[model samples]
Target: METTSPHYRHTKIIATLGPATQTRERLTALTLAGVDLFRLNMAHGSVQWVAEIVALIREISAEVEREVAVMIDVKGPEIRTGDLPEPVVLTPGDQIHLFTTNATAPAPTDVLSVSVNYPDLPSDVAVGSTILVDSGLMRLKVLNKDATSVRCQVMTAGTLGSRRHINLPGVEVNLPSLTEKDEADLIAGIDAGIDFVALSFVRKADDIFALRKFLDDRGSPARIIAKIEEQSGVRNMDEIIRAADAIMVARGDLGIEIDYHCLPLVQTQLVQACQDQGKPVIIATHLLESMIQSPIPTRAEISDVSNAVREQADAVMLSGETTTGAYPLESVEVLKNIIQSIEPSVSSDLNSRIKLIEPKEKMLRSTARLAQDLGDSGIVVFTRSGFLAYVLGALRPRGVPIFAFTDNESIFRQLLLPWGVEPFLIDFSADPEETIQDAFERLKEKGWCVPGSWLVVITNALANDKVIDTTQIRQVE
Candidate 1:
């Protein structure tokens, strides 16, 4: 197949690298199969293995003469049960006691015993809150709560082994999103020059800012991806979206947090929000669940992928399918074919389905539309807030390259997957005109525009610092 096959256009594929597809040969095959990015899940493998795979991916990208982004996923603070003798199966209506202490034997009477690391977990959880174990494989309801323990009735019983994750829905478990292990992994990823670092379980914008600072301190400038898994993250989605480079709809844990039936709606809302902001959003997890073992995807799975494409997600990720699948190559091919089949059906109109409340008051939108109308060779947005770039992105002008110049390196690096948006970090200009001139000169130097090409510049006007107020169309001379 041709390397620049239409099958891969406009759709970014993130394949998880694992024992099955860790070799140089398999990595090369995946890249040729249209994998645009490689995911090194730090939760599963050692730092040495991850480092080896990262090196292999770079080698493959060099051989192909294409830039393939590498993402290192940090395993955030996950609360889990202690060691169990074997898989413990519970039937419906079974009573279970989760305690803080590590007790080897089963509970004295009607209670099944399990241990939690946090001693005050029971006090933190209130009655009526749901306890999800093993990534929502089992569900329990808190019937009573005390200072150190909570009594729960099993809602959905399943076999669970040692270290299965525990989630308390609607209850904030006081824990840091980035654990000690994650901090070490982040350093390793930065040292390896990973393109993106996915921060798992991001609850607020502060989490993103902290991670960005961490990267700066390490002198490893990588794009920070905020994984939206909790309800808090979703509620504060706009702030988080503004703070990070991109957002990932981590559906696995998200499904555990919200009703499964509500997932589709949540996914749609998140995609639209990201689109409106001009931020790239990824629909992740279970896109091709059956492909782990089988060569083909289920009809429902195909439809799911098609729906995500239709929703205009910049990327769709496969976790286990590419990581530990029996048919990793076939899975990639199937994903490629599905995206190719769906691309033509995707709407190209920038504002076709956009529902902008108070559209007249949105100066960024006005500037973006004016930029599109000016018929410039390219559009340049000078923004410290990243709002202007996102506004221009929402316009979706055909064939016009959008360059985002910002002093914030994090904002610039995050624009990697957004359609037509190129992020560059420039020294902050003293004035707006200077900023525009500097942008123009930089474009010329980079060969994005010639001396005679028209370029549109958008930025904040004096009247409203909160909104974009200036749209200047100038021909470079």
Candidate 2:
């Protein structure tokens, strides 16, 4: 479609832009090496930084003539420790006080204590609750509490630095999904025309609905990606998945909230659920942890990526590996290489794994199976909203290339994230048959339609259905 070639591998790559890959040269290299989306983590950057980076990415997209999607990941209602002069080191049985007040620092005490940003932290956490800091790098158990402070015993000791995250397992912290800071970020991101917004620490569908309402109010078309990293999020996975445009299995904080052994199962379930719904799912966090320093990834890291591919995850993401890593370019290259190597085996059989849950899915699956059965045939799908394109892409039929035609630019960009669907930005015509004929002419011009090469033409206009209406198999003249 559009003369530009599709990636050899169907699975997309999302790279985080940070200190390492923030420059134009590094980002250009990553874009050329097949990074489909760039995630700007709001937890770290200021508004000025985000605006500048978004401008640079848009400039790069214009130069490359590719629609590079930008995602601004907002920091939701999450708690973090305040600034400390030095890292606090504690051993077993050491008492640490977590104060919930403006006075972040205690008066130079030998005993360890730090102030948290949330004033209601002590009220929410019980004496027996467990507190994890910096994704379980340091562990503490609540031993006592008062009106403004919660004193804890250091169960697992590590260096506790300034502005570290705080996690209370089995404790429900009543906070609004969107904080004031998140609203500011979202407004700025929408003004900058970000393609996606990832909401962090999402606990239920309501969180996603609130963000959606905000976006709709501003008439912004930026899609919402729910970051699932909490136990409540895991429990409400179905509602969250249905509510959000996409999902990211954020394992960094998830490992701290849930048992370590359960992370894999949760990841698998999330990926499978997203696949079943035809929504994109990203496997993120510590995928190539070692590559942050070393030039190469560990064997387990390779297998981890490979496993996501085998599971038919729509995409895999690089967090720290492409952010502050010394080997950012190497990490992207290695991830690309691994996907290229393992794609052929898994992509061809991806349709079999998808359960046909809905009528649209059933029709789409049958269309894909037909195209695969008829060797040397190509598929041309005309979608107005891009829903049908995503459905077919999720099915992942063998050997058949899908040529998707849509007029909407947002749909064109969203189509890039899905697998097997090569999207083209074309004008919409009132006559469905005329549009089909025009699309075929373009395909024939590109030699995609050759002698004895049958083609399957699919569209949603023939039936009364709103999502997807029709699939017709035809032989090329």
Candidate 3:
């Protein structure tokens, strides 16, 4: 399979892990198919299950001799209907009482009432408010309320399943950023040595700050990826982009919570915002959704993916398409094909979009320009923390491959999430010139370059007994 050929894919791919794709063979197949990261959605499995899957993924990565990162997406501050003894069918104008489990249940078990996971629903919602159950499949209008319960008339009818997600459109409910279960799952993921933690429903910068503090308290080196799926998150986008290490335009609930028509604009805006700040942003949810059933994706879905690639998002994610879909491998192949086809057509003048404020930022912008000037050039960097490589990836140096070398295995895995970065793990030498020559030899050995290939090597090496950044060009030998 040639490992899906990373040459044409500047935009990375992230796939969710599920029962359909949980086996070691399936994981290996997806990794070789160009999956840069595997998302562990905490919404589906238990903590123990997540730890075991992480171990399996690590094993698969070692066997394949490739770097694949694992991200644990925390189920944060979700509102859902409680379990039902039987499926409840509702029609227009049918009324039901909704209460928290802490509140007293109605006398009869057959009553047309349900318990919500959030206790604040009664106080948070008001009369004439529209509440969407199960991603707006059924609509409920709050007609009346009391201390512990809110009486609602079902405006739209559907079968209400247990633990169905509840959405209060145009109403903001107060909930802690990290639910009890979220904290537990995060702890397990951190202990399992996950590369990234994606916090869901990030409404404000404080949400990211709190999660960062949580990870910091435990000395977890994992970075935070803020999910912008709520209007509040969009409203507070500037701060959230600054607070979180990376951002994800989670279009699922954002489409339900806000006007679906505006989702495209919001996605581009979020991606641009994250890029302007040099943060890697992911455009997630339904990139190739039709492939879930059919092997071929719809034209509309392909266009959606092209838009994300054209916008230069760090990655496009697969949810059900790779998790529970019938065509997991095809989904990845389709995405990779779409990305490679469109990326070549799009202009790589994104260097103008970014404001080079920091000295290193300005330097990397010049690096990209210089690479363009050199023609047939590649940027080689050595970083223990992967910071220089991340910034260079953000610069979107089209046609110039950035080969990042790191001694830290964790950083090697973490670097896979960034665009345009191909991470290589190698042991560094005590001598600076020796290490640079070693990088050159590795580039040649891996067929990244030939004898006459020009390489741009960037590193912070000891010079005159003090470490300083250096950039120089060398021909592969």
TM-score of each: 0.78, 0.90, 0.95
RMSD of every candidate to native, in Å, equals 6.3, 3.6, 2.7
lDDT of each: 0.77, 0.82, 0.86
lDDT, candidate 1, at 407: 89
Error of 3 at 148 (Å): 1.7
Candidate 3 yields a Cα-based lDDT of 0.86
Q: List the candidate 3 regions with Cα displacement exceeding 4 Å.
A: 1-6, 104-111, 461-467
Top candidate on lDDT is 3
Number of the candidate with higher TM-score, 2 or 3 = 3
* Cα lDDT, model 2, residue 76: 86
Candidate 2, 244-284: lDDT as tens digits: 98899999988889999988999999987887677788889
lDDT of 1 by residue, 81-177 (tens): 8898888888789888888774344454667777888766877787887888998989888888666566788999698789889887766667876
Question: Judged by lDDT against the true structure, how good is candidate 2?
Answer: 0.82
Which candidate tops TM-score? 3
Q: Where is the poorest 10-residue window by lDDT in model 2?
A: 1-10
